[model samples]
Target chain A: GESVGLHLPTLSVQEGDNSIINCAYSNSASDYFIWYKQESGKGPQFIIDIRSNMDKRQGQRVTVLLNKTVKHLSLQIAATQPGDSAVYFCAENKGGSQGNLIFGKGTKLSVKP
Target chain B: DVKVTQSSRYLVKRTGEKVFLECVQDMDHENMFWYRQDPGLGLRLIYFSYDVKMKEKGDIPEGYSVSREKKERFSLILESASTNQTSMYLCASSLGGSRADTQYFGPGTRLTVL
Candidate 1:
């Protein structure tokens, strides 16, 4: 079955350190990728997004890197804080689909004090 | 701030009962989506609506149906709720575009089917 998946299920990092999360997607036709952060008991919030035309996109303190060759994507959070502790997910969407998205299993990021 | 509100933050229901999950967005976005999140499963699309009275099935639309009578409101209905249907349901909305636009989400409705 077609699916998107993450490399790690959980990650623990000390505060102020940088964190990187990776995702693997199966759909080669996917043209857009999005990263989301979900805190406990809350819905997923958009962190950043990248288009297939570009390999990297940067937000305030986060960056999204896309590797079309390997069908992989990564999200990097700079100067992680305890507030950043949450599960992160990567989603892919092919333009031809009916506005549907394929989501990965998610990586739980823990920022220790 | 764009606000997407789900009617209930928590819901408990018995098996075989009909369940309705309501979502309303204040952004007036053209696209609305319903998804279920579970441990390790991330977020799975249940159904989505592009415009009023328009809907499309998503990956896990088997036990779900949707209603979009108006632009701001989208509803997810579980015809016959089952224990396996217990999960966190999330609603999101975004502007219609070639690039599956950035979505704003509601807090979520945690459904418990017993």
Candidate 2:
């Protein structure tokens, strides 16, 4: 069975520091990956995404790195703030046009001021 | 922005009772999905519909069914709710396309079956 997993269940960082959340997926055929942020009592929101062909993609203050060979994915947040505290999940598109996502166990990120 | 809304923010039901969770999307997307989130399980897909009157079983579909009578609405039905069904249910929608399609999720419904 294909599965996605995170290396750390929780991560804490001080404000103004950089944070990195790592994820590993077992499905080699998965070509699309996305990072989502879920705050307390809210639905998960899309943060950034990357295709298998791309090694990395940059957003406003976040970046997603994809290492296809190792089936590893990471999200990097620069200058973490208290507002950045949330549960981060990495998902993979398994069936292409089917549009179903396989989500990894979330990594709870806490940014203390 | 894409807007997805669920019928309830929280619900409580007894065992053996029937339950329905409704979801609506204003984006006119072709794909709608129902997922349940647990403490350590993250999000697990229960069911999904790609078009009206069309549906498919996801990774976890036992004891659950879905209805897609209209394009904008998707409903999840529990024939007989149980305490094991208590969890946060999330509804999401996305455009129909390749794997790159981004899904937009609604505020989840927390159901407690006692």
Candidate 3:
């Protein structure tokens, strides 16, 4: 079965430290990947995205790395804050069309202040 | 800014009842989707519409149906709501074409089937 999964269910980090959340996807044909953050009681918000042709993409305080050889993806957050605590998910555009995405079982990130 | 709005934030319905979940987008996007987010199941797509009056069944569309009478509005219908259907239903919209286009999500509606 084609699926997207996470390395860990939860990640705990101290405030001001860096956070790394990992995801493993099974589909090599998946070319586009996206990272999203969802706070409690809120929908998932887009964090960043990367394409298969690129190895890394950086955002304001976040970075996404895609390793197609290992079918792995990672999201890195710098100087983690309490407000950054949320459930993060990684998705791949492998659902047959560009509008559909296959999502991972989210990683809960808890930042301790 | 793309804004996707659902009809309710919390909804309670009885088993054997037909339920309707409405989603509206203001950006006039051509693509609209319905997804259910569960604890360990992740986000499963129920249905998606690419154009007016056109829809496609997604990964988990067994217990649901969809309607796309217009471009901005997409509706999800549950013929008989089941307790297992209790989950957070999220609606999202994105610009047509390209896998890199971002999908903007709504606040989500938590549905409880009693």
Candidate 4:
């Protein structure tokens, strides 16, 4: 069955260090992928997104890398801060649908200051 | 900014009671969705609507129903709430397009069915 999954359940990182979170998707037809950050008691916030045509996209302090051949996706945060501690989720849109997203079980990121 | 607002941040409901979760978006997005978030489980789609009065069942729609009578509002209904239905319900909306639009999410509704 087609699904999206994370590689880790929890991640502890030191402040000012780099953080990497990985995701694996089973649907090859998925053309769009996005990363979201969720703080406690809040909705998931969109961080970055990448289309299948692009392999990598960068934001202010975040980067999203997509690998189509392996059906893998990764989100990287540079200079992790305490504010960056939250659960991260990866979502995929398989197209043909009305822009609905399939989200993965989140990976909790803890930045130690 | 696309603002999605849920009616309640936290709700407590008794078992077997009908529960309604309301969501409204100010962006006039054409696509609206209902999803439930649970521990160890990702966001499971319950239902979505592309246009007013037009809805589609998502991955998990067995115990839930949705209403989109207006373009700005989408509602999730729990016919008979159960303990297993206790979870975070999230609402989101996006411009109708070819999977390129980003979804704007509302602050989830944490429902506790006891």
Stretch of 10 with least lDDT, candidate 3 chain A? A1-10
Task: Please write out the lDDT profile of model 2 over residues A1-113, one tens digit for every residue.
Answer: 11235343778999999999999987999988889999999999999999888999999999999999899999999999999998898999976657888888788899988
User: Which docking band does candidate 2 fall into?
Assistant: medium
TM-score of structure candidate 2: 0.94
Task: Compose the digit string of candidate 3's lDDT tens values, residues B1-114.
Answer: 789999999999999999999999999899999999877678889998889999998889999999999899999999999999999999999887755467889999999999
Per-residue CA lDDT of model 3 for A57-77, tens digit only, reads 999999998889899999999
Q: Whose lDDT is higher: candidate 1's or candidate 4's?
A: 4
Clashing pairs in 4: none
Candidate 3 local Cα displacement, residue B104, angstroms:
1.6
TM-score attained by model 4: 0.94
Tens-digit lDDT track of model 2 for B1-114: 999999999999999999999999999899999999988678999999999999999889999999999999999999999999999999999997655578899999999999
Comparing 3 and 4 by DockQ, which wins?
4
Provide per-model DockQ scores: 0.44, 0.51, 0.48, 0.54
Local error of candidate 4 at A27, Å? 1.1
Question: Considering only N, C-alpha and C atoms within 3 Å, which residue pairs clash in candidate 2?
Answer: none
lDDT of 1: 0.89
Look at candidate 4 and tell me the lDDT of residue A71: 95
Question: What is the DockQ ranking, best to worst?
Answer: 4, 2, 3, 1
Q: Largest DockQ belongs to which candidate?
A: 4
